[model samples]
Target: MLFLLILFLGGPAVLTSGRVWPLYGTPRKTVTLSSYGGHVFQEEGVWNYSTMLLREDMDVLILGARETIFALDLNNITNKKAMVKWEVIPDTQEICSLKGKTKETECQNYIRILHKMSDGRMYVCGTNAFNPTCDYMSYTHGNLSLESKHLEGKGKCPFDPFQRSTSEFVDGELYSATTLNFLGSEPVMMRSLNDSIRTEFSRSWLSEPSFIGMKHVAEGQKNPEGDDDKIYLFFSEAGLEYDSYKKMDVSRVARVCKGDLGGQRTLQKKWTSFLKARLDCPVSQTKLPFLIQDVFLYCPGDWSTCVFYGVFTPQTDMLQYSAVCTYRIQDIRDVFSKSKFKAMDSSSSRWVTYNGDVPEPRPGACINNNARQKKFFKSLDLPDKTLQFVKDKLLMDQAVEPSSKEPLLVKKGAAFTSIVVASTTALDGSIHQVMFIGTASGSVLKAVNYDEETVITEEVQLFAHSVPVKILRLSTTMGQLYAGSDVAAVQMPLSSCDHYTSCMDCVLARDPFCGWDLISNSCVAINSIQPDTHSEVVQSLRDGKASRCPAVESSTTIKFFYPGNMVSLLCEPGSNLAQVQWHVNGHPVENSNVYQIQHNTLLILKASDSDTGHYNCTSVETIKGVDYMTQSATYELRLGDFMTDPSVQPLVQEHQNTLLALKVLVIILTLMLLALVAWNFYKGYFAIPKCFNSDEESQQKTSGCQKPLQTGGRNSAASKACSSNSNNNHNRLSGNQHNGDQVF
Candidate 1:
């Protein structure tokens, strides 16, 4: 019984709890960049792993390779004529090669940033063979061509292609957080408009920051006294003020005002609106902090309800796991407004909180009407003391915490690389958010949140090769997901409704984009149905109740077998969370040496006449507090004699025929042997000598073949007697021969 319990619990049963439920099939459509002329260089080491941008209105995808940029048609990606490519000049290649860098790998222009300006033109930046440069790409007459005007790209793009950087373009201005030096030692957050305004954090403010993402959020306030738009940047940096023995890296969320100009006479041509705070995403069970990898913004309807989903991993690489945490916009705002200020105390040589009075216009506040009322219309008009205070108080003491202490999804064995989110409206008019997380293995995990529990519905392999996914873009208008990798980019549909073949599969998927259609008996996309006619759609994803599914009746199958034969019966319960039970003749079957149960299979070893009976299998499932039972078709097993069974009649006949054929072969060989013996006798093969008589051998035995002398000596003794006996013997032989001739 213990062995049976172990097998039942640890067998090949699907786990529908915290683990991922594998999808039956992949997406229907997949478009790779190689199908078009995206990478025509065709070199061994060159890669197209740059970021990707989707223009849904234009129905095109824009991506950058090493020195080229490609625009692909989204509808028909394979149509090469609809594609366009632009290759930047390689004039600075020789200069970059002389910089002691790897010419083959590093000393090449790598296109990294592509942002569309407020005008029709696009702003592009590249490493430019280690000499960073930026250019404008004009789109006119259905063609994209590079302009002659070149701008310095030190603060706009990173000097290394492998460096982590982020940029966003808003209102003809570019805001970016990137490394500006060749060695990637100097990290800066800069804004470039008519004039570039750059700021580098002091060691006390930021230490070795690695930027991940940047987003421009607009505050939807029409009041003239309200603040303007703001740009938030997310990064992870080494902590310098932590009172610990070892150094630690902390995740940070920073914000900057959109309208702040450079301060005059104090911090010229530099940002005066930079303020950052720590971001906390802690595991409740382990109490270990996680480092942020990537962040995605989920804004369905209003900006106030927007949430940021961040992918985090342990600071140390010893733990091979990842987690996802969500933060509301309101929580982030509260942290920035109410957090204390941290400043270095030179007297004690340690960091301490500043309890001094704050400046009038609160450091890092957006330029509002209040600033204008105080005769400070721009950052240049602010006092020198105000600018110094803002710079010194850049680091906030309070950390921004996630909404839940527990993570939304904690995945083991894979590190998340990118993330995107979408929302769907259920029949109850509630909005549910679904997250699609990309991993380092070029696969995507689809998960949904049911109250507080996050369940993984499916995992899809987006690339044939296991290259890391560099970028992931979601298009709500086209209902597609675009993933970029080192070799190619693939476009797949957001929801694969047709993959679900049955009502149970459709409901169990818990996909917001899919629902069961009773008319077609298939899973269909919610968007495909008309707005007013979807009342009959069955959408019980949360409960997973299969009551609406039609029950199938299976017929009894009778099987015959001889005694001592092994029998196996298969039982399919259909659901992953079900327990299978086997019964023989309406009595429960117990596990023993002769009877074994493996998953949904019942094995009967060395079956006998007593084992002949009706076998049935039942499946029991417990969801919430209710139990549902389903039964399989009955199996009739009968035992019979091996020789009398009708099924063994042909085999018995075959054995008899084989035995008769063997007997006939033996008889034919014996007859042939007899014939050979008779032939040898007729050919005189067994002839014997007539003088070799037994009595002569005893009386006149000679020494060898030459017996003349011995015979003479024996003859002298009985010459007279022998002569008389020989005459009688001759007469007797003549009489016998005459008698034999008369008989013949």
Candidate 2:
């Protein structure tokens, strides 16, 4: 009875089964710059989105193009009125062309710097036709307009639009690290306080530096005697301390005191507290090390706990691969404060650590109360010897390693151009950080950082064309992402919850913003939850645990033929990480002539009566050291005699039976027609005589009449008399025959 119940409930089994289809990542929404009227065109030059800034308070995003700036509203990106465009003047074009620059390509203004000031205005800078320029932008009454006032942006901006540079606004001043000349041969790190206190041209300061970014690090409030606000600049420059034999480009992280003023006498209007250190990002197995490409600062709460995420690539092939590493703010401070300074010893002709007599106050220390009370109030009070020592001793002897020791992400096939990170709480209430990396192919990859490893959650195509994404900005307050490419700027939501329909898909996505809502039976963004409403939501971004998902019951069944029949069972596992297993009659499958496994399918060759049983396919996955198993629909296989069993009969057998019946009917009709012909011949209905053959009786009677005729001569009288007697006998015979006929 139990077997019959299992058979009835399990239903018929299928001949072929395999794993389920996998789900690919896609974007939920995408808005291009053209949709918001932010795209601009130039007849002689090309325009590209090179820089981006997000304004969470006003719900608008700012994008920088070649000679143009666009402001797009985040709420309605398609509205034309919600966007604004501002273009720089073309007065420097002829001057740049006369200086041997390409008019159609390089001799055009390219907006590079867009720093928001503490006031309501913004400081904008551009490479105006190979002559760097800066201007003030005012945003009042919800309208962005450029001011007529302009400043010489020599050290504060790069003359070439394609040159890499970075700038930051600190204490109503702009500190930038960029090339200062039109030829792009001179690189300098300058402090622009009304453009008078900038660094003078000197080889000891900066040697062809390609700056990535500048970050402002403030002192911790808990430490009363801690350092002042320090502005750190990350870049790569040509190593000058070493000779030509050992000359190579080295990655560096330099820091400057925000309170530093110009020196008193000899080194006037120069940075008196400038220092730098080496940043190492080497390959583990090869000599190809990672060159710094870009950097982003993530400060969650405290300055000491801040992290710096940097993108690096090899110089050999720019389009092949890239890597991302993280550095803690404390580690950087340690390298800057405790590491020894590198100096060139002329006598030895080699670079070595400084071991000379030290000054009373540190050369690169910020001006504090002790120095102020001693009449050393500012950088101007510092001596020329101390300033010169700091100028030549910028590079640190020790190198700073990344916090993770290894890269957080190593992307292949496409080079990474920009990166931004965000954090979210998982179901376990633990914070998880997710990194959004932009590629040169105009795609954004979302990766989650877990305890064991980093898992790529999804990839989104941000642009219709394969243009490089130059800038990426994330708004954690609004949960939106802004990407800028050469062709256009795009805005999209960070989490695409609608793409994940089921609990399994939502959990496996590993996206902290997505959760499976039990009340609605759909995946939804956690940020969309109402403040007062309460609902059952499950998020497993860290561990990808799907224990809360409801069990799925399947009722589908399949059946196949028996005896020398081949059968294949398909079981869809749904996930690429899952392993498929086959079970027959509630027992695990074994390799034999009757059963063969092919990927997610089970093949049975020459099926017999013993092979008849229930078959099931299960998928097993291991996530965070825990096993998860899911079973597919049950299938029942039955074997019976091909000749007698109706269940095992095929449709072709019915056709064969009909053909056999037609042959039998034809044979019966032919036999009946032959019997009718034989009966007609027996009854002489088609013949002329009743006797069909002449026998010896008739021949003997003819011979007897001839013998009397031959003796006729001697018996002529006898013949005549016999004739008379015969006539009488004939009459008597006729009378007897007539009587016999009458009696009958």
Candidate 3:
């Protein structure tokens, strides 16, 4: 049965272990840059923020753009930045133009790589008019200087600006996954400078891949066997593993050992420790598969326990849906080290799990202490049979499952493009992971990821329009996030504490960066508070409860208006998560035509004699299975008919036995007036007037019937003439009767 299903899917099923993602989400607050006071950096002609590097030690954010590189101050990005400019020469532009590429867009230097070298220098690269090149750069005294010579960057940098690639400088060597040709046909994962190990030139190895990012991982002191460090690449590639109805791309994570130096003869110049596995992040109960767009690696302390936070979107463009899934290092390691190998059946041409005898010592096992004990210290020492076996069985049968068996966050209406995670210690002494996700719409969603449930605290909008988030960086120590788009780069604090002015708002925001300070009686940044007053600060990140806030007397806003006037009582709420309710004379405000609540505003349809009372507005918010209610606002609706001396006690805040007000009264009065008019019209209270028209007697005006418009002098004369004709006709009929003359 498993083989049949695998053949039907066109490839072996990688979704053996998976779970569902919830469709519901919390109400998140939206903030704009103009209102939130975020610092922005946009040089006169600088655009296309392709790459960003945050150096907390130097207190600056380095940005890479088209033909330019900028080093903006972390304190305030609006300040002038240290810059280095690189442009494509005329000869290079001409050569690029002759290749059938757009001279204006493709024939230019687009800075793509900004890697830090081991010696504290910078390694930067650009697509120099379809020709990639690299240079060493130095930053000193808030300025940038470049090395005299440049290196060929065909493998180090992508030939095109839009192609996705990942590279890092590890231990004075470069490990990269990118396309090497001018047309970007070849995709290779290689290690250079110290080793010449690369992937085999076969479709089974890559199959048209789009690389996301790469991370170097060593088992650290926690490893018992001291395994060789590995570089893992995250990407999405076409489902060449299947022969389905439509071309579907699957997310993948591939590993390559640092010590691999290719094989002696069987797979010469190719890595012997190359293996790939699928990353299963199926969204919703329908089991819709999502393609990975970006990944952020979070390591608490040891490299062995690193976490990969991946942002995904569905291949179907029906909805702009996105999700963030988390994968642990141990889960990925187990799949490659212990999971079964996926292989193609020779007779059926269907991909299936291999049940044959496994190669001894493992085909792609790194040279750990176990292998070293057996005298296999490197890839060159491995037998030809192991190398040939690994080359054909590059894919593992089992996939790497997510940590929680579900996505950390799932959202609709926004296509998430990049992400950065931060671990924060809230006032409750509990650690929480805050994920800052950048969207294609140029907004950042700050989502608090619980173990199984997720809540979005807020959304900060950076650009006024849609601009893809090309670069996103986070500085944990500074509590700031840097986001770059096609237009500019923006630096924003992790939280807007000032936006939550009240104690209830601060606590209910569920923001780990903000807390309600009892000493100052205001919402403040947690880091800005004094250490001595740490206990005085209140924060509840788990459920965002305001139960710790002391009760206060809500000020009554007295509003006096004339009778028959409409009064709108507004309830300004602090948090979007709470529901607003209004009360009149101490009872729940019944929603009638006369009394309406719209967009948190209470409207008294028309202030009348009986509309004199007080209106109280309250907010009820649920946090961690507990409901917390607070009086947000109060209003005294005093009609002119009830205004009296101030010494007298006012009316109650809410009214009981509430009935429909002005609208009902008006409807009854209108009906009575219409009935009386109809009865009198049929009874002829005044003397009835009859008038006739030659066109139609039924169309003439008369007081006994439904009257038409009363015309003046001309109609009166016509009525008199018609009366005379009737009288003469009656007289002639009497004379004819007297004369016994029968007229038919």
Candidate 4:
């Protein structure tokens, strides 16, 4: 059966009548670059990977541990750093006078949050004096304000600015989350704008058991009528049922008005409420718990409509994995209007619960003002009376029709440890929502929904795979990503000029920032191209220049010369073969070889005027089939007198013909003489030449011509003997002797 099939298939192939044979195909070229290996980094610091701010104005600012902030250029110029506009704030322990602050030496008291206010001032907040103090500084010129109320005396800061604080500026108000002290944190959300400031604690507003962290993602984001700005906060804690059980159900996204902040306090309505809802999380097991570690606001162009993205994970010690949950801001506002969980005259609202096997406590339980509760209450400066009227107007059972449409629920089951969302305008003028995440295993993952069908994920393992990512933040410009933990800070350029393929390859190649120094074995940038710096071969691409390549020429002939020799090659204007290589016969010359390849490949080599030959160049190309080998114009090298050797000349004409005829005449005469002598010798007689005077006995042989042995003798031995005897006599007498004797 196999033989029959083979014959059937071979019929047309054997005939060679059809065109399609073996199916046309080209090799798939997939680029592969390594992501593993190690090399020394030029910058010194640990866990400083998260970026707090990214601006495209050629200036990128990043906040790291130990108060290390780096202002770098769009192009990575970290090395050969002439001057780093930087300053390292001392650790909280060394600078803060708090008793145990010095004992806890590992505490990173550097700046945790950075935001530019409406006044063009950059506000930096530290965890405490031990954590550093909250201070406002002019971003353009380094003008720092009095270190708030936190940095005073032997050191008693009202708040720990570095302690997981989230700050946002809205309508001239700076809202932030801060722990009151280092000992037992009195976590609270504070608002400051001009002269007025106020604080709302866990006891009065959120009414939660405790607090975790807060993230304010809405920057200058507001409601349509522009009456009030909505700032979203995500908070997490242990559930009421499972006291020690760290559950994500305890995590809640809430909205508050910016105008209500830093105003006259009221019993029940100290802060104007907007909305709150439990994140729809996916988790298992009551013992293994979850919490909202961080929150990020993402507004992909449609400012009025935005997605609230949060990082939900287990309590630090109990966390099994990480997850990312997304909810719409409109849904959260629904929670505040409900009668089931409303603050009526200072009385806490009823707590609701769910029976799902998900994160323990159901949504609706309030957040007790931790880091997660600090919102950019830059809410549109609305009248308190209007907010009160809206709250009063909202009926308990009546559903509030959200101004914005429901958020498209995407990526419900996956987890992440940290998330930061930013809006960016693509090169095409379209806006996109980007979420940056740091995984438990120290993997930095970026998630973006380019379409309704797909979510893109690109991740890089930042740590040694063991150190879980503690924090991650992407600069607003989205140009840098920073990841930090207990160890090191890693900063990478988010947008670089190099191709993405080349970037991956460069990473895989493990080329260190150390500039390549020919004197030493190191990988360096070719830009540092000083003679002594390094020997690098830079590839200059000339799109469709010239072809001086011998490889493109006919295989039959090739000529080679040192560089600087003048030789030329011709090529069509639109040839696919863009490059030309000059070969001597068959061998290719090394790049450094004296032969120079030019733009036109007029193969301009500096010739000593002596170099000339049938120089061959080939224009090589890989096309659909049959690789093309194009030959250049054939050149006949004509050298000047000094270049040509006179000793090497073509042969003379007369001597050539004379030699041919003289040789023919000699052969004919010899043969004739032999015939005569043989005839006589065969008849038992001897013969002598006319010129030879021989005895009568010897000479008498000439008369006896007895049939000459029939010329062509029947006996082979007789014939040979006759031929030999005749041949010897011819040699004895010559034409010269006959001619001379005749004359005498």
Q: For candidate 4, which ten residues in a row score worst on lDDT?
A: 23-32
**lDDT over C-alpha atoms for residue 684 of model 4:** 60
Candidate 2 regions with alpha-carbon error over 4 angstroms: 1-46, 82-91, 193-195, 199-204, 220-223, 240-247, 318-321, 373-375, 527-535, 552-621, 627-744
Q: Candidate 4's residue-wise lDDT over 1-744, tens digit each? A: 233224434321111122221201111111111232211122555334343544344354434344444444433424221212223245444555445444343345445656666565555554444544556554343222333444321112223333344556666666654454555345555555443333345432333323434444342344332334445555653333222122222454555555443223231334444334444343322223245676666665554466566666554443344444566555555555333432333233423232223211112212222212343222223334434433332112222221222112122223456766655443223455656666666665544444331222245566666766666656644355655665655555432223222221222221121122323323333333455433332211111111221232233323334444454554331132224655543455444434665563544456545455555565543333334343344434445342232322223345567898999999999999999989888886985444233454345356321123244546656656656766666766676688889999
* Model 2 per-residue lDDT tens digits across residues 1-744: 233223323221111113121221222223343332232222234368777766666666666787677666765444322324444356668778888888987887788998888776778888888878888886567677888567888988899888899988877888998887878887877888564455557665677778888999886355456457888899887766544443356677888888777788856777777777777664433242457878889988878778999887765552355677899988987887677777888898767788776564666777765666667877888877777777777667777777976676665656778888888865556787888888777777787777746767766777654787788888888777777777777777777777665676677667788888888889887767654433488777667788998865654575756688788778877455667878887899978867888888889988887878899887766667876664466777766556655554665688899999999999999999999999998898876432323464344342232224345566776656656765787789899999999999
For 542-634, candidate 3 gives per-residue lDDT tens digits of 666677898745778877767777888888655567678888888898789789888989888887878888888887777777866644678
- Candidate 1: minimum summed lDDT over ten consecutive residues — where? 21-30
RMSD of each: 14.5, 20.8, 16.4, 27.2
In candidate 4, which residue ranges exceed 4 Å CA deviation?
Answer: 1-51, 77-98, 104-108, 128-132, 138-163, 193-226, 240-249, 261-265, 272-276, 283-289, 315-319, 342-415, 421-435, 448-457, 475-480, 493-744
- lDDT (C-alpha, whole model) for all candidates: 0.72, 0.71, 0.80, 0.42
TM-score of each: 0.74, 0.71, 0.81, 0.47
Candidate 1 residue runs with Cα over 4 Å from true position: 1-46, 79-91, 94-98, 138-144, 148-150, 223-225, 552-744
Better of 1 and 2 by TM-score: 1
Best-matching candidate per lDDT: 3
On the 0 to 100 scale, the lDDT of residue 415 in model 4 is 44
- Total clashing pairs for each candidate: 0, 20, 8, 56
Per-residue lDDT of 448-534 in model 1, one digit per residue for the tens?
878766767667676654677778888888777777777767666777778776675566556778888888888888878777768
Among these predicted structures, which one has the highest TM-score? 3
